[model samples]
Target: MSRPAGTKDVDYAQSMAILRTRFEWVMLIAFLIFLAVVPRIFSPETVDIINVMAIWVVGAHGLNLLTGYAGQISIGHAAFIGVGAYSTAVLILQLGLNHWWALLLAPIMTGLVGMVFGLPSLRLKGFYLAMATLAAQFILTTAFLFAMPGIVGGISGLTVPFPEIGGMSFRVPENLYYLLMPTAVLMTFFAKNIARSRLGRAFVAVRDNDLAAEIMGISLFGYKLRAFFVGCLFAGVAGWMRVCYDGCVRPDIYPLMDSIWYLGVIIIGGMGSTMGAIFGAIFVRLLHEMVLVASPALGSFFPPEIAGQLGSGLGLVVFGVVVALFLIFEPRGITHTWEILKGRIRHWPFVFAPG
Candidate 1:
């Protein structure tokens, strides 16, 4: 039977969409498989780097959800993660809760806190909102520092129990890798789905034009809160995973600079793209490690004291330069560059000709 012209066009479009999606999934799966096998082929040190990269990826995805998709600027994201980490620590130390349950509930509690912070967004926008979030970072940090020996242990920090599954405690890097790898994969998957859903669309709409979104019957307040909750939930999960990875939690671990770095990750990663989150996290984290590794080599050219100082300062300078370069040259991020490359490849036979 011959289909009508409109029906045929719709079918063709749907088929192309499905093909594109399948291709993306295939590429992602292949990359993940390569990552999964890296430890087997490389040294333990390399595996450890991969593990750290995975954790950053998880945190970046959460930040991406807010700053990228939802169009919310958050400078205090590390505070949210700190909230989750400290919450988990308190639960285990003071409440005598199981580590597993603490991990599960930490994100939920953090999400609630995020919603409270997001409430300011309904009345504020742009720099004001950014300032509010900055305040959250400072206020939360101070609270953690001054909450006494009973709350967050003040300057001392809290010890995190090793993650246990049934009878197994993940003490080694390899064991922790197994636990972290799955969570990272699942978090990435969830982020991708959320970005493709009605909620994601609503977030983009709010970001693009909150007034128009409101005119279209979308509740600006509701969706903004939802974005905050979702983003903070990811932060909370990342925090829980970090505690498991580090075996302890400290207020010093999450500082104002760390929150700024999270924002930089989303910006350099391409904001709304899941692939962007992965790319940004890997690039930033690796660049950080590279600076540390190269510090000694750089130090050999200078006096030992000078070299040590240069090494300490170079990391921040390099990070700042990278962020500035991306902002000036590739504002859409590395993901957009990948898209352009793929598009050119897909249309290689149909290169445009000067008319």
Candidate 2:
């Protein structure tokens, strides 16, 4: 890790510590406090946006661990999220269970489902592995759409009650923000810790070279499955969050395009890092909002006949252009760029160049 001048690690403990200085600890605490109070500061619409960002953070983290860290390719992550959303709904509605219990079990159910699809990782890889997971997306979504109408609710989907306990409900935007943002923060902590642990190192090894990892006695089967399970587990948690936020669980909610966008999130945010997942989610969500706003506004500049076409088509064009620009110029993603800026700032005056 890069540090400011005079910063030195004298021991392994110091080197490994996330908050090495008083400033670091202070910043972390301040950030937490800010998150806690953000709903009070932002508009209700913006707060709702933040809630959605939280869901993306959780979903992106799952994909980061699997595709970015473990090198397992999946294009159907949203389907797993659907599994979680539907599972939670089923557990709560069909079984007469509490939403709390559903929350606990739904993610586990999704993880198990992910592991089943992950079986192909033992033999197939790359495009083949992606194809396998894509199949999972279609199969699971098909089931969600047509499985047991009485249980899964089929096309109309299931209606989930708002999260409530002890007479307090999180149905409103501000209250839901409190419920969601903290969960995203907790998941961030979990993902960061996982990235630095022994398991995380093993994941990196497998991602870099699976055969080499196996030669080094790393269990390819175990690690790959664990990656899929854990990643999909995050997706499940995100699904739960989304269902709770929307008050419904429908097949249309978790689309294949969403899974692709999650992949794009990690790619544009920088893969293989927890912060990358976060940065990517914020960037993508903000970009989405900006495009939505800008598309209609740009139509005003065009003639009436062309305005309608421009309004409908500009968003896709802008999205493609932005993604292309990032891929061409900043393939490492925003997190890597952030690190470089920090490095330059820290080394300014003596080692930094003017340009």
Candidate 3:
């Protein structure tokens, strides 16, 4: 006997739901396996590249939370990251603190500093707000370079000692991967959850229209400060990671260009989406990596002097071109593109079929 129409529909819906759940689990497992094996399978240099990607992605997540979700622009986001790096270096190297303690304290310190700088947001908006952040960048950079040079190590920078975790020393890429990848995974999960929570909704409301959000009982100042704190916390953690992995903390490491690049990451990846931060970091970093590889290969075609210059500069040119293309054609970013593709796949044949 044929099943009733309602029963068939219900069975089909249930099957689809089960399939979706299974697919999600399978994807998560596959990704975890990849993270585990990638360092072992890849060369040491490739492992380094992956490590850099994770570090920057963590930093970009912070910017996305501020600019993408909270509609607050920070041209000096890298300064906060510098704070974290310097803080970690001082805490671990100078103060004789444990790596674990430095890791915990860096973000907290950075968050407090961010909140202080973020006070300007209460009075500024748009270009004015950007200028305030730009000032912050200059001021913090000066501090890093000149203010109490003995403390920040001035321009020479501070050496970062190897981190000891449990009984294992993280002196090599294979071991360090455990420290970084897990932190990245945890922070990304935290960002994702924040985006779906009540505060995340308030952030969206403020971004969409602050005045309306105010009328709806959302405190602009409070949310804005919280966003900055959270964002800087992420930057601080990433900065701490840099010190741990690179074995040094330099003032120039977090430059004005870096702050801009972080913003570009979110723009290219898609604003207001956690995955967009990750996508943007991977996309931009991969482009930089490819340029590094190809530039030397193309050097043979030119004079040694010219080849050297091209090798050094071509990456920036390519990065600029890619950013321009994304702005012109896909302003909503890669996340939006993914969503469209996903919707099409779900709807399938009828999506493109003629009437």
Candidate 4:
């Protein structure tokens, strides 16, 4: 934590403060103000996109914690999310719980489910662990699709009405944006704190080397399961937001592709940092949105039959190429790139100076 000239910490509190400088505080306040007015300034469609981005940010944070910090890879995160969404629906519809209560309980239930799936980490890891989770993906999907059609809604899925208070309906994007954004921000704050805590340090230690961590008295099984529980917990929050956004829950909504994209989000945003999750979500979501917008215009240049096919697959092609390039050129992700640029700016003429 380098400080500007004439800035010196005189107390422990000031030294440990997150917003150590006045400039940082100013920027934080400005960013919050910008978020506050987004829905009022943007169109409904754009607001809807931002809402999805917020939800993805929450989910990506979870994946980052598991894969990035804990070194536990999961390609089945979307299934965990499905577990959360279905849990929420059951709590609300079958048990007669309030929507808000369902929202809280669903993620806890999902966390427990994640821990059960994570038991294999006791004996397996790396590629084998991924395969285990991949199996989890398929098994959960099957359960969602066919285990109990009457309860889970089968292919038809479950419907949830908009939450209401004081006669205000959250069915519209504009109204829902308020609910989603604050939750995103709060979750982000919570994640940032977690990353700075003892638990986060243990995760980092386990990630760096499990043998070394265990040598230092850190319990591998305890931390690994905790990582899975915490990671999937965030996925559940994202699932709850998804239900609010779409007013329904279906097996199709939580697909294998989404779980894959969540990994890409953390990879591109830079893996070990909290902000990487936010940056990655914004980048990937906006990229997909761009593909959606350009597909029709691109289709006009080709024959009708091929045009439809090209448009349908263009996003995947572009996304794959971009991720490949990022992996090759900047494997640490956008966060590292930003750090380098900031380092140069902080040193001015001595651009190569170390911070």
Steric overlap count per candidate: 0, 0, 0, 0
> How much RMSD separates candidate 2 from the native structure?
2.1
Q: Rank the candidates by lDDT, best first.
A: 2, 4, 3, 1
- Which candidate comes out best when scored by TM-score? 4
Candidate 4: where is the Cα deviation over 4 Å? 352-355
Find the 10 residues in a row with the least total lDDT in model 3.
Answer: 1-10
Instruction: Quote the lDDT for 290 in model 1.
Output: 93
| Stretches of candidate 3 exceeding 4 Å from the true structure | 1-20, 352-355
Instruction: Report the lDDT of model 1 for residue 136.
Output: 91
- Tens digits of lDDT, candidate 1, 1-355: 1222223324655554423355557987898898677767877777778788788888899889988998898999999889888888888888899877887899899999999998898888889999999999998888888877676888878886797888888877777788888889889989988997788899999999999999999899899999999999999988888888888888798899889888888878898999899989988898889998998898899988798799889989998999999999999898988877765555555443212
User: What digit string (tens of lDDT, one per residue) describes model 4 on residues 1-355?
Assistant: 4554457788988887777778889999999999999999999999999999999999999989999889999989999989988988878877888779978999899899999999998788899999999988999988999988988889888997777768888888999999999999999998888887888999999989999999999999999999999999998888888888888889898999899999999999999889899999999999999999899999999889998999879989988998999899999999999888876776666756544
Query: Which residue pairs in candidate 3 collide?
Result: none
Model 1 residue 6 CA deviation (Å) reads 19
User: What lDDT does the true structure give each of the candidates?
Assistant: 0.85, 0.90, 0.86, 0.89
- By TM-score, is 2 or 3 better? 2
Candidate 3 residues 47-83, lDDT tens each?
8888889898899999999889999899998999998
